[model samples]
Structure formats: structure tokens, C-alpha cells
Target: MAAGLLLLVCAGAVLYSAQAQDPYDGLPDDYKKGVDLAMEKLTLDPGVRHHFRFLKTLDKSDIESGFGVKYIYHHFYLKPTRCAKGSTVSNAQTCPFRNDRPLIDCAVCYKTAADQIESFPKPYVHCIQKPRLTEDTRTTRTEHCKKMNYNSGAPTLLAVSMPKN
Candidate 1:
């Protein structure tokens, strides 16, 4: 019975790890509201009324707290559309809207010390109309939000890309 108890104790202690955590676990309610705002108004074109399809918010393990503010990254995928008139396309293939799928990221910085949570004015995360080359250099839109620096401690999202077709 003593040996069984010792084994059980060791097993219990080994299984009692508590580091498990969700990146968005302690996120402020306003963050969701901000995402909603982005969803409602985020568009591919200001003049064309082309709205973006909200994919997901970029996740980070370092999002628990900050002194003054927290930046919430909201990512949305925008399909390629015709380039607006007067825009210079040096290679024609490099025409931003013609070949590459634009991944627009809205990074909203929320004031953490605010007295009013919901009433706080929405963050002005500008639309990223530019696209970068994909990591694999492939044209398919496989660039969903994921953590970087796998072995290293600091995880980050690589910039959205415009890979070669």
C-alpha cells in the first residue's frame, strides 16, 4: 500500500502542470468590439465598397498584459481585384491587386488603463493594402495566422506576403 501511494503521489504531481493558457483568455471585452468594428467596416476598397472577409485574429502568447496598451492584430483576406486607375505597376505582374491576394491586418492598440471599456473610441488601425511574398514562395493563400520562432521563446506573426505564382 505504501509503494502504491508513492507511485500515485508521483503521478499526481507530474500531471499537475498549470502552464496551459489560451492567448486570448484575458483579452478585454473591447477587443472583440474592436474586431466587430473592423469586420463591419474593413473593406478592400474605400471607393468600391468592397468589404473584407474576416478570417481570424492573430494569436500571441505575450498578450496577457502591457503597461499602457495592447495591440490586437485582426487579419482578413482580400481577393485580388483590378488595380485602380493611375496606379503604377512597374512589372504589370507586380500590380498589387492583380496577381497577389492582399492580406489586410488591422492592428488596434487599446488603452488598458481606460476607465470606460466599451465607450472607448475605436482604434484606427489603418488598412494594409500592400502584400508581401509568401514564405514558401507559392501563390496559394496558405498564410493563415500562426506563431513564429518555434524553438525560440518570442513568437510572432510574419508579415502577409505576395508570393510568386
Candidate 2:
């Protein structure tokens, strides 16, 4: 009986440590700040609660990564309908060809297209806006930013979210 109790205690300790070591555990200070900022901003939008359940799923790293911010914007702007079961694709932007097709009914085509895009070089791109500075007679002038491109294959905006630290 004592041996069994000892084994149980040991198993519990191992499980506790495993949970503690999860990748998302102990997020950085910067990440927490980002998340707080995002949450504050999101709270002001009336529709945020309805549309963004995954906001809770996010950790501080997600906000810090900028993916969380983009995700909120993407869903707010695009509002892609969720795919049904057995669907090969999740995002409508990724599968423009089959806009009307039900993903569950046409799994093979969806899968093939999704796979192709996945393998396609630079499938996803992000343009970061940069301010342009110009010299004027009186003072320096700053113009509205231009988009700088970032390449990635993930279809969803979440793909680019904060990397695990």
C-alpha cells in the first residue's frame, strides 16, 4: 500500500512538472503588456465578444507576436464563414475558386487546393507600413506609410502570430 501511494505521488509530480513546462507557460513581460493593450482595445468594440472567443485562448506571446492583433483585425474586416466538418479549407480568402462550395461535400478538391497553396512559395504575404521621410525647406515631412512585405505559407493570419519563446 505504501509503495502504491509513493508511485501515485511520483506520477502526480511528473504530471505537474509537465504542465508547468508547457510552451505557453510563463509569458514574458512585453507579451503581457501587448495582451492587456489588445484586450482594452477589443473591449470597446461591441461585436468583439461575439466574434472573438479565441481571444481568450490567446496567451501573452500571441499579442506580442502581432498575430493576435492581426487576427482580431482580420476577423473584424473579412468575417469569413466557418467551414463545416470534413472541410479541407478554413479560410475563404485561401479558397477563392470554390466560394460557394461546401467544404464538407467537396473535401478532395478543397484539400488539393489547400495543399497546393500550402506548398506554393510565399503563399502568404504581410505588408508592414513604413513612414517615408522627406526633406522640406522648413522641416522634415513624414508621409503615410508604405507596405513592406513578409512571406509565409500559412493561410490564416494566426500563422504569423507571436513565436514561442
Q: Give the best candidate by lDDT.
A: 1
Q: Write the per-residue lDDT of candidate 1 for residues 1-165, one digit (tens) a residue.
A: 999999999887767643223223344565555554554455434553433433345632223233333333343333334544333324322333444455655544333334222223334443444454343422122222122111222222222343546
Instruction: Quote the lDDT for 54 in model 2.
Output: 17
Model 2: weakest 10-residue lDDT segment is: 103-112
| Residue-level lDDT tens digits of model 2 in 10-57 | 999999988545231243433333333333344454543321111122
Cα lDDT for residue 24, candidate 1: 31
Residue 155 in candidate 2, Cα distance off native in Å: 38
Residue 22, candidate 1: Cα error in Å is 18
Candidate 1 deviant stretches above 4 angstroms: 1-28, 40-45, 60-101, 112-122, 130-165
lDDT value, residue 93 of candidate 2 = 22
